[model samples]
Target: MRQDRAIRTRNLILESMASLFNEVGYDAATIAALVERTGLTRGALYFHFASKEDMARAVLDEAVTREGLSPQAFKLQEWVDLGLLLAHRLPREPILRAAIRLAVDPKARRLFGTRWPDWVALGRELLTEAKESGELLAHAEPAAVSRAFVGAWTGVQLVTEDLEEKLNLSEEIAGLYELLLPSIATPAVLAKLDLAPYRAERLLRKSCGQETPEHE
Candidate 1:
């Protein structure tokens, strides 16, 4: 019971820190602000996180996870869903938004490295599987394609946020896939892909009452 309470308090601290980091970038998410927002004593907050930088690193470390993604017959479709779902959820979830903000901020990134490599690795794994299954073009190299795709995806989100604070994230990502998929995917697989703005929402709805496991 005591351990449970400690875990809960730690989570509350992280949640409060995420909210501040989301609203204002890392530089502005001060330790005092976290204490005020969390209504926790300075000692208590420090007990969980030695400093604001520690909190930021924790958020960045778990920034993007592969939880809640339902498996698909096509690994390429799974990859598409991963991006679409992140777009769908980012605007609504301040924690994830905070992580993205930290990732892109030069100062914060120096303190806590960006999670781009992890994302690239995840993309490479999926693309490799798709290629092995003959879903990709003969010349599609998974490593190079995944790296480029992650770069493009990061650019797309930054642009979308600049334009409208992510009001059009799903639409923007859908357009990205539409333009890029043709070059990588085979004709049959391309035809089967659903690059809709609401694809993630539909997937969630379909996954209702179902057990969709997380990917490591």
Candidate 2:
């Protein structure tokens, strides 16, 4: 029970910190701000994190995980699923949003490097597997494609946040796949792919054991 309470408190602190960081970039977010945001004393916050940079680094550590994603028959499909899921979750998950913001912020990035490389590594791993499985076109290169896709994904996120307040990221990311996949995937593989924006929502419902409509 003590461990459970500690875990809950730690998570609460992280979540509150993430929200604060997202609202005001990393450099602007301070220990005092977090103390006010979490309604926890400075010591309490310090108990979980040594400093503001420490907290930001902790959030970055979670930036590239595949917690909610499941394995797919096609490794390429798995890669798509990961991106779509991130799009769906980013808006709702302050930690992820904050991590992305910090990664792009020059001051924050200089202090503590971003997780962009980790994301690219994961993408390359998945794409390499897909290539080995005969899912990619002859000219497609996993290393180059993975790096380009990560850059495109990051650009889409930044542009959407700046230009459209109400745009859905899942839809935007799905559009990205639709445009890029044709060049990377074989004709047969591309035809079999499901790049629907709502795929993540349906996947969540299925994971929760809730009945998703077949039409979706």
Candidate 3:
């Protein structure tokens, strides 16, 4: 029972952290804000995390773990769908994007292994699955291409969010397809990995809370 309560508390902490970090960028957020948002005492917070960075790492992991895209023997198209799903999910929410940025920071580079690593891994897994369908370039490196896929999506997100200008989602999606279709998808595979829903989902995710894209 103690262990179960501990797990519950930890989950509560992670959920609280995800919402707080999703709403406010890490630098702008404070323990007071976390406490106020969670209604957890400082001692209770510490009982779960050693520091905010630790909590941020937990949040980053929670984001990936809850994404419903992690490996479970998914097919190539499914892999692509999953990879693009994450790509779409990250940029739409300012807070989640900020946490991703924080995870990649030199000061908090540990998150690279946790969050950044998985994004690319997700891409590679999908690309490899495409290979099984014999739809990818024979000379292509799935892992490298996968990283590029996720990276390109992230780059687009960063630009759009920072500029906060009217975005052309069609143009962005077209540009992304132009880049990846050349290397990662054979004409056959390209035909298979439908980009429309993935592209639409990102816009929908951004419109909703980026942290949770469930209903949207």
Candidate 4:
């Protein structure tokens, strides 16, 4: 199973690189550090990734891989779940943390671009679906709303990370939705939304084949 071994090696390199980048920004994630952390030879590392920039790009490519938010009857709820899930997992998921760090770092951004557009596109798609399903306010424009929401969500994450206890990110994000949703969502749909911090935990369990009760 050469393919399986190769996949495992690649994943190992990516995980080690993510941890290194999360701890110290992209510039500081030298090959030596990656090799030491992964306990793999420099040749093995180079076989998977030509350089640190290459590894950073690979991490950025998979920035949204862990986003497996289950489908919801309300598309807007899916959008909210996506943000909450990321908020819940970002601190624990080194790959996502590293990707965000690289995206925000001016130096690293020059080498590997940010995934803001991809996230914005995803939001726009969900919001468009929600709007078509009559879940949003009559005047809510999907493109504009999604763009603004993505920007606001990014700001919330940055501010939360700066706090003494960065673990409260999910709460901060839930509060953000509470403040913003009233303006974008219809009264009926608004009442149905779940903005609780624990929402992400439940969503994660549901994703892992656990039975999660549907929220109203």
Give per-residue CA lDDT, model 1, range 71-124, as digits (tens): 788999999998898888887777777888898888998988889899999999
- As for TM-score, the candidate ahead, 1 or 3, is 1
Runs of candidate 3 with Cα error greater than 4 angstroms are: 1-28, 63-75, 91-99, 110-114, 168-175, 198-216
Model 1, residue 63: what's the lDDT?
A: 71
lDDT per residue for candidate 2 within 1-216, as digits (tens), equals: 988988899889888888888888787888888787788998887888888888888899888867556777889998998899889989888999988988888998998899989899999999999999999999999999999999999899989988846988999999999999999999998888889998888776666664643222
Q: Candidates' TM-scores? A: 0.87, 0.92, 0.67, 0.89
Q: List where candidate 4 sits over 4 angstroms from the true fold.
A: 1-5, 165-167, 210-216
Best of the candidates, TM-score: 2
Q: Report the number of backbone clashes for model 2.
A: 0
lDDT of prediction 3: 0.63
Superposed by TM-score, candidate 4 places the C-alpha of residue 176 at a distance from the truth, in angstroms, of 0.9
* Alpha-carbon RMSD, candidate 3: 6.3
Candidate 1 — worst ten consecutive residues by lDDT sum? 207-216
Worst 10 residues of 2 by lDDT: 207-216
For all predictions, the C-alpha RMSD in Å is 2.5, 3.9, 6.3, 3.5
Better model by TM-score, 1 or 4?
4
